[model samples]
Target: MISAISGSVAQSFRPPAISLAARGTESVQPKGSDSGKSSRLGALTEEQKKQVEQLKKTDREVRAHEQAHKNAGGQFTGSASFGYTVGPDGRRYAVSGEVPIDVAPVEGDPAATVSKMTIVASAALAPAKPSGQDRKVAALATSIRTEAQAELAAKSRDKLSGKDESDSKSSALSAQAAYTTGSSPEKGSQIAGSLLDLFS
Candidate 1:
């Protein structure tokens, strides 16, 4: 029997504050000052220059992080969105970003769901340095995949032993419960070993 699963997952990233000085400078910039003229009239203070460089670095990192998710997720992911903060240089820089990923299981097909979850987990960890949310999504996908594998193992066991429909479903439910709660280490291990054998 196919387990019911739903919902989507997105990984969002927001770096920590660059520095205390940078934060203070952000609040003091004139709202409507001409950036070009100001740069031409007087060179930026060393602190302002450091803040601009930090913002530039953050912008590059945010773009790369989202792009990694998009590239690995393929059709399962949507376009990335960014949250911007204006730098001391009066240019907008991406301070945070998110990439939405489809995490819903394929209806009535545990094998297909397993495959999809594997891809989803891979996408979540595709970046060089995954954020906390990215790790959570990966862990969720892994749990879903394990459940699907348990279901598949149950079906295979029933077919081999010639169990009737009611008995088959009971076995499947038991297997799913064992995997979910990890109540019986031996039983869980047997199911997991069976899954490996079946897939391998």
Candidate 2:
């Protein structure tokens, strides 16, 4: 007896579906809608708004320096300083400036990859003194700083370790190039062995 598979069974091994939601889309709101107003309720106040605008200017300058330092493979060192107060309306405000830092790569290897990033935040406060409402503001700032440092430190370690895979590939490429350039078979084997040992 002979058995045959149906076309539908063969077609069952088709490619998986693709989702297009990953691409961004522009949303259009209908006329006379209240959705837009509610969306902006948490924005900074007039005084805070002015302060944030000033912060943007400082941020641009710091970013420029940070980028230069990163390109040169150096360490990034910067500080954010601020003086702030709270108003009777329960809003805390402050003026702050961030000094840009130099970023450098790890020492020893000239071709070592390095990455540094910095952002400067500056602002001025309308009421520049501590109050009950300001207490919460201080706490919030402290929380943000702590969490941000922790996150950055973790992410940095992850990024550095992830480079190991790429470095192994680079070593393999170097060994292949050396072999193709008339190096002895023994030397090429040694190079490849060293490359494999890197991740080991």
lDDT of 2 by residue, 7-112 (tens): 2221111112312111111222334456553454345578855655565554454344333323332222223322232322222233222222222222432222
Name model 2 segments beyond 4 Å from true.
1-126, 180-200
Model 2 Cα shift for residue 97 (angstroms): 27
**Ten residues in a row with the worst lDDT in model 1?**
18-27
lDDT of 1 by residue, 168-188 (tens): 899889978887987876866
Error of 1 at 30 (Å): 14
**Candidate achieving the largest TM-score:** 1
List TM-scores for all candidates, in order. Answer: 0.64, 0.27
How far is 14's C-alpha from truth in model 1 (Å)?
A: 6.7
Query: What TM-score would candidate 1 get against the native?
Result: 0.64
